[model samples]
Target chain A: MQVPAPFDYKRASTLAEAIALLRECGPDSRVIAGGHSLLPMMKLRLARPEVLIDINHLSELDYIKVDGNTLKIGAMVRHVTLQKSHLAAEYYPIFAEAEEQIADPLVRNRGTVGGSLCQADPAEDLSAVFSALKADILIAGSYGTRKLPISEFHTGPYTTALNPDEILTEIDVPLRSNTGSAYEKVERRVGDWAIAAVGTMVRVDDGLISEAGIGLTAVRADHFRAKEAEDSLLGRSPSTEAIAEAASLAARHCNPFADQRGPEDYKRHLVEELAKRALSRALNRSLPEVH
Target chain B: MRVNMSVNGVEVSDEIEPRLLLVHFLRENLRLTGTHWGCDTSNCGTCTVLMDGMPVKSCTVLAAMASGSQITTVEGLGANGELDPVQQGFIEMHGLQCGFCTSGMMLSARWLLDHNPNPSEKEIREAISGQICRCTGYENIVRSIKWAAAHSQNSGVQQGVEA
Candidate 1:
């Protein structure tokens, strides 16, 4: 039977209490929000935290709203909530697209944004979606709060910039007018992780590409962001040639390892194709008449 | 650790290890074995239960984390010893071949019908996409959920749901 090692579980009523508990419990302690990712890791003996501080009761952190031009999502917001939030869909449909492909509905009901980000799995879809949206993450630690760009949040696979005494509190996506975003993933099954997926955001100004962001996942894309492909799309007309060229750049740059999903060449091909489709959809959505 | 939670409308308390999963707690501690335990890794939905009225894989949830929460297992689907429409649908439509995945499938169907009284075949399929059924190939399972939707709409929603 898969079971976690013995540990003490503490439910914190307040964020301060949670942080204090984390500091007191030491590095062997973990702050668990949804626990979907952590618990499974624990069961496999891959993660052996001696203390778990449950933050599910910190309802104060479970919110998604627009604070001015920024779309702010609380870290504790459940995946199902994120998938259903019209506010998030209004700004970027990528949230729904990515959330739909995260896992089964049952798993999504218990998974949280903070937990997903902190887990930092390379095949995780939200990281690519948020990377494409150019979002910022707010992390609260014993010292104070720190706002880090999503691009810099993941230091490596299964790792983040969060400290042991810190908890990610919120994710902020900058709302841009004349911009549209989409996420495209091709998983082996309905709920499996992506073999290679691409998320794209494009701002069309006067029939020209004003801003472009491309995020790739499950293909060893560094920081899950394709800066070269994004840069290639800027200031250019959203044309077939331009998009294909950018897609080729994204495919060429990513380093995908072979696995049961497919060979490296096939994954790279998916990266190029998915990137093209996502960019086209994003460009189409950016046009008011097209939408 | 001592945990208190409502299981099937009854307040229950149990002394459990913090690492004890909710599935194990329900099966061993509470002896509600109707909720099947499969794929201890959380990949299989056989360990699903209603946590605060939403379907969650209990295998991945710690019993200690369920303190003060309301959990409804497969045994709670019926009322007054009457079979739920979901269960009836399964019987009438032959939704199960082996019945190993029946309880979790029924609970997910119940939750789906609760939220959407008349879900399309596509919607029903999407709702239970997380669950694995080695038998039935899901064709009859989809029809079974549709049957539940029809039955509920005809007889009206029984057992007022909170949610």
Candidate 2:
């Protein structure tokens, strides 16, 4: 019984054509890649764009490759591709681990990585995974291309730093040699959104943790991360006490809202517990002896 | 807008609205009601179909996006009036009680067996996790997929298109 409001549709053969369509259609327009996230919202009357520019044919933007030291992932890369990228898994196991837990196989087959990131749903798994990896986003506009750190990409839930004429073309994940990342999530059912989840990347040298990145989702973590917690981990030994302190700090700062998922206290507890588990797994991955 | 796509291996062209969902286009426009409509939110896989040989929820995809793609619906599962191994497996394993989720489940199983000739019970379960059988018929569904996986080699008429 649900359907989108009547709108004009244009399929963009190239990125330039897509940008021009966006500009010509004005701000009332939206470009759809996979349309998994956008279409559902369109049906609910939550998003009412006057024009829809389809960018599915832009194959130039669908790729996963290594460019120097960064693993460059195209915006048009589908979720299934991201999940199966052995190159990405070699660099960051978090990519495959998180992709497996996002939605379902059918949904993932059509959902593009760019569409998921652009949708900017607070509970989306990849956003947290990207935040944990400190990935950079590339945006293209009529003027030219500009780069923004993924930290500054999401302005708020369901919103981003993208202008009307801008399109996210690629994501740059800096590959590290001695680093490991993992994601831990707890959902009520199969393919459901996380009630509370944590993604962390740890770079350990000798016995000291050189860098730590902790990203939380659904618990309302600021910028989808626990900066205070990550800061506490700087140059600290990968000891149980150090990890527990960071985990506790991560759980303390997050402000979770209650819904059918659970109460706030339960989510906060999950943040702390899941953070501890993910951090432990990442730390172990970084150190082969204990792994 | 006018859309042209191969449906069940048939070349079909139709004039349709841009907002039309693939599920509606298949059912109302093409009269391919074998692809059911359930939980329009796209969470339920009742409207699942193969796009370029991969399973996708048709409700979430715009018909415009499927213009150049090859779509295989439930009606296309069998070849030359013979049931696909998946369909036969469904019957052999008693996969359906209410049969509401059968079409989508069978299509997903067909896709799985096409890519992976033999899938374990866990893999079969994962392939159809997006679908919901209100009848709670998962046990039989898993058995049905395993049957298809076992029978896939013997019965090779190919899937999707006859061509």
Candidate 3:
């Protein structure tokens, strides 16, 4: 009985073709690739467009390549691909870890990195990983392509800066040498959305933290970098006391609501637990010889 | 929409509604009832199938998206009438009770073995984490996958190591 809303379907061979279709369909079109996120929404009647622009066949967009000092993940790269790619595991371990943790294996085989971001769900695991990695998202629209920092992409819960005509092209994650990153999530059950999630990336130089970034999800409108917590840990060793205090600061800064997953108190507790665990794991992996 | 694809090793094409799901196409159009539709949502892997040798949730994929791809359903799993090794393992290990989740479970296990071949117990669990089965408690299912993984590795499939 599950069926998508009636819509004309078209397969686009290239970005230009896709954009042309989008432009032609105007506001009644929706682009779907690896519909782990979008298809379910459509079946649930939450999203019903008159045209479905199928872009999964655009094989050019399904790639993971090293470009200079950053790793470029194609927008169509499925979650399963990210989880299994050795390139991703080496360069962006946190993202790979988080990608593996998203949904189940079946969904991963069909869900995509771009769809997760474009969906802009506050509880999505990959969104927090993108924020913590400070990745750049490439957007291709009818006009031209533009890059936006991950932090600026998601403006609110279920909302993004992407225009209706624009399609997410790729994600660029910087290759951090001698850095450790970890993604820890607290969910109601395995393969479920995170009730509250934390992504921690730390670069430790000679036992001292050099650069640090923290991303939180499900506690705010969208995944956001915890600037206050990052500031507190930037120049310090990840001592248990220091990490605890930093995590507390993160918990304080987040504005979480009482959702079906848990209440605000429980969610705040999850932040502390996840933040502490993620920071410690990242720090442990950041040792010069860990790689 | 008109879709033409190889389903269960058979070349077929049919006129379908634009909203028809790949699961429905396989079940209703091809009459491959072995592919059961469990939870229509992407959460349950009851209608899992291999699209170009990769396992995908059939419930979530539109039939229109599968115009040129190769689809392998549970009915296409075994060679001839013999049970596939993964299916055999499930039977020997008593992996199913009610059997509602069997097709998806077997397909997921095949995907895991074809890719990993020798997965650890944790990996086996994680591989089929998307599949939900309320019967047989999953202990036997995980055991069956682990059993098949060990035997499949010995059967000559290469196990790629993760760095």
DockQ of 2: 0.83
If the candidates were sorted by their TM-score against the true structure, best first, what order would they fall in?
1, 2, 3
Give the number of the best model, judged by DockQ.
2
> iRMSD (Å) of candidate 1?
0.8
Interface RMSD (Å) of candidate 2: 0.7
Misplaced by over 4 Å in model 2 are: B154-163
lDDT of each: 0.92, 0.91, 0.86
lDDT (0-100) at residue A266 of candidate 3? 92
Report the C-alpha lDDT of model 2 over A14-115, residue by residue, as the tens digit: 999999999999999999999999999999999999999999999999999999999999999999999999999998989998999999999999899999
Q: Chain A alone, TM-score for each of the models?
A: 0.99, 0.98, 0.95
Per-prediction TM-score to the true structure, in the order listed: 0.97, 0.97, 0.94
lDDT of 2 by residue, B1-163 (tens): 9999999889999999999999999999999999999999988899999999999999999998899889999999888889998999999999998888889999999988888776777888889999999775699889888888777754332332233
Q: Please say which candidate is ahead in lDDT: 2 or 3.
A: 2
| lDDT (10s digit) by residue, model 1, range A176-274 | 999989999999897788999999999999889999999999999999999999999999998999999999999999999999999999999999999
Q: Of 1 and 3, which scores higher on TM-score?
A: 1
Q: Model 3, DockQ value?
A: 0.78
> B63 in model 3: Cα distance from truth in Å?
0.8
